[model samples]
Target: MSKKNPKTLTVERAPDQTSEQATAEVAVNPAMNAAFVVDTYQSNILGDDVDTDALVATLRASMDKSAAGDLSGLESMLIGQATALQTIFVSLAKRAHHQQYQRHLEAFLGLALKAQAQSRATIQAVIDLKFPRQATFVKQANIAHGPQQVNNGHANGGDTVRALENQTEQIEVLEGATHGGKEMDTRATAEAARGNPAVEALATGHRPKKRGR
Candidate 1:
């Protein structure tokens, strides 16, 4: 007998299963079918995208069908819609939270700015009060110790000097008070920017640190 060629003896085995046969054998469950239907409906509603009224009507119909016990398919459909709605609601909640935080931050900054403005006004008022008093004192001093009075060494010259000295001392005290007020204002602004408890106290014209101790 002639020896058979090894290459000729090789035969290609047929695939265990064709793609069409595999697909035919696979079964789609009711839940999967319901999910697909829900997805398709949502896609169509989104594509329309013109009015929320249509979406609402569709949702109401689904809900009504779910409420009626006549259809068993409604259960899976309701579950799929509920899951999608949950995701949407969660996203809305996150956006709302972010917006709320932004509003709060803006309100806080507004309050801080208001407090700083009030503090600055108070400091300005203090300076205004001091400058006018100093100007008056200087005018009185110059009038009391005019050239004639200096040349003659007027009897009241001692009293005039003492009065001017007292006035100077008063002006210095007012300056120190204004400086302290300014320092307090700066501290309050910094604390307010940091969202500290000191902000409330500062806004209310009270010192939080002193109260805390």
Candidate 2:
């Protein structure tokens, strides 16, 4: 039987070859993807005027590093970091806080995010989590919620709950244990509450208006 050494599995690049050239060739330039990010990111995330050169450089460097890596994990790590740096630049650019200070903030954010892929991933995750959902969007779109959780998840209960959440106009729940008599809610409630045609003038949010010029 032969014993395998773990070190043998690790891949190392040749020291003589240039990393930047290899990276540029292997990885799609990050700046190309950044354009998509700029378009897709929150409307409030970026200012009209941005330091294009700096952002481009950061993206290029990130992609270059990513393409140069021998492993896919390294690629993801680089992409993640690039995205994070873009976010920072975009956010700072949105602010336009000072005379010449705008450039400094953008630079700082770019540098800070570029240095740490893990940090960028964390921040990006938080931002993703915080993004607002449309009222109709199901809360279960978040994968972190759990597999059993449905996107359009509803509260668990019987017919009574189904009525309330769905606005069924009529639903009933038994009040007592075991022998509890079924309560009739569909009785004289409507006429008593509205008084026939006396209160027909009130308008609900969606009620259509009668025509009268």
Candidate 1: RMSD over Cα atoms? Answer: 36.8
Give the alpha carbon lDDT tens digit for every residue of 1-213 in model 1: 995442221222348977656454333433334443555576656553323333334555665665784443444544455455445545544455555577765655555555445545555544553454543423232343323222234567787567767776777776665554653343443434455555443554543556565
Q: Which ten residues in a row have the lowest lDDT in candidate 1?
A: 5-14
**After superposing candidate 1, which stretches have Cα over 4 Å from the reference?**
1-70, 100-213
Error of 2 at 54 (Å): 1.9
Candidate 1 has an lDDT of 0.49
lDDT of residue 59 for candidate 1: 56
Candidate 2 per-residue lDDT, tens place, 16-86, comes to 75877555533454474574365446346665344444455566676676578534444465567666666
- What is the Cα root-mean-square deviation between model 2 and the actual structure? 23.7
- Which residue pairs clash in candidate 2? none
